[model samples]
Target: MMDVEVIENSNKCARCNYCRVCPIYTVEGWESASPRGKLYTIKSLVNGEIDVDARVVKELFKCTTCGSCEVICQVEIPLINLWENFRAHLNSKGYILPVHKKLREKTFREWNPYGESREKRADWFKDLKNLTSTNSDLLYFAGCTASYRTLSIARDTVELFNKTGLDFNYAGVDEYCCGSPFLRTGQRDLAQKLFLKNYKKWKEMGIRRIVTSCAGCYRTIAKDYPKIAEKLDYDFDFEVLHTVQILDEIVDEIDFEDVDVKATYHDPCHLGRHMGVYEEPRRVIEKMGIELIEMEKNRENAFCCGAGGGVKSQFKELALAIGELRVKEALNTNADYLISCCPFCKLHISQSLNNFDKNINVLDIVEVVIRTLNK
Candidate 1:
């Protein structure tokens, strides 16, 4: 049975097509691709007008859940939550997407989402002798991508943290997926389980504050955790912060060497819009003494990199295409680097740049900050 909250909230949409006009669907140009269509289908299922078949399920899965529709919705409906509830409902009924199901299995079996062992999580930080302290109040939750795929980010973040004289510690093998992917994909039960595990571990470790380089993890930990804690009665005493926020706070303490580069920033969906963190990253960029060019569509109106909401895993080509569009936006700025605070955004946009014959550089905000810091 669908939760009463889900049923009532999902039915609240008045079928207005404001969400349909999103740039993503506009660029893709399909009715089924619009948020209104997805919501309508979900509403029909709740009203017993349609069955939860593979086709219906696929329609729900198509969304990146970028929350663009929610921002433009006249009724202020929680479109992403509705989609997540629909996903959870579908999953409960034995209708799970093959890609998401496989990824979930891997996440459950191996603490990391990439089916890698947990011990290797901190292997990337092996050479950082400056990161030896565990008693520091600052805890760096490198997320899955920085921990595994973009190990350089992990190293650079540590180097920057030390260079700025901030005592930082990592969750190391104890860090798991931030449950953002699972939550975004409608695996709420799995997300809750991972949340409880991570929350409890962090609490016990006496971590008073947490920071993550991944926008997805930042959103989940900073925003979603409090909600989950209320539901699960888990008491969280720590403050969750993004690396950009921390770096911005400490920007005055560091002086940048003259490194001339024109850069544009890509606002990760979760970090910028979902979490209202638009200024801190831009502040970091401006403070770096670099030429910060704005993308035509930036801030809340920014386009998604398409890898969000498990789209990268399920619809690789679509994700890449969306990423390519974002790359073009950066290239249009004539920027040397596309500085994004999210690791996943960096990964997708960097891949798009490489694959699409673009010379634009993609960088994480920490990398940029670290490079600017006196070595």
Candidate 2:
């Protein structure tokens, strides 16, 4: 059965074409790839006007779910949630993509979508000094990407926290994936299991505040978890935050050496449009005395890094294409570095730059901040 809310929301597309601002639609150019086209297709499927086929499956899963369409939609439709719910519906009907199927299997079996060992989840920080025990008011969740794919982000974040004298804790091997991958890829059941696992662990540890270096984890825990908590009748008592929010609170207090550089900030979609975190990262960068340049599209209008919503894993070529466009925007500013708060964004944007013979440095804001302090 089709979701009633999905049906109602699909019926709400105004056909204003404002959602052409969608990054994927701009690249794919097929009307079927457009936000409106997806909505119409969804409505037809929901109303039994059409049947699911290969073309329908491909078009539906093509979106990165960046929430750009939601930002531009004149009818105020919540396109991001709509797409996820529609995908969930599809998943229930066994229409899961092959890569997404592997993603689900890995996440459920290994506690992360990357199929990485849970034991090595904390290996990124193994070499860092002054590690804390599992007990503290604060927890540093180095989501799957930072712990495995972007080791420097996790290390730099820990180093910054140590340098700044912030009392925090690390979950070590016990730190499960925050389930952003599951949520974005329509594995709500898997998401719930991970959420419950993390939530129970936090509660048992008496954790009052949680900080994550990854934007996807921050959004999943801060924004998505409470909804799950309410549904499951869990207490959900912890305060969740991204590292930039913590940096923003403390940036004014930190004294830094002079590091002259021109940089541009890329707002991760989970950090920016999905969660309204636009200025804190920029403010932190500017506070460091770096000349912060703005991209042609920024803040709520920032283009996606194309790594989210399972696109990079499932549709590699399309993801890189979208990512290349964002890298071009960063390069157009002629900046020395491209900065972002999300490790996933940093990882994808770095890979995207490899497509060009000329490349720029891509660092997480936390990495830049740590370097400035160490200098």
lDDT for every model? 0.83, 0.88
lDDT of 2 by residue, 238-346 (tens): 8889999999999988989888899999999998998999989889999999999999999999998888998999999999999999999999999999999998999
Candidate 2's TM-score: 0.98
Candidate 1 C-alpha lDDT tens digits along 1-375: 886777787667777787864645766777777887776776787788988778777767887878888888888877777777777777788888889989999999977668888878878877677466467767889899998898888888888877777887777788888899888888888888889888777776778999899999988998888888889887767788988888888888888888888899999999877889899988888888889999988999898888888888988888888888888888999998899998899888888887666598788988887777766
Worst 10 residues of 1 by lDDT: 20-29
Worst 10 residues of 2 by lDDT: 127-136
lDDT against true structure, model 1: 0.83
Which candidate should be chosen as best, given TM-score against the real structure? 2
Compute each candidate's TM-score over C-alphas. Answer: 0.95, 0.98
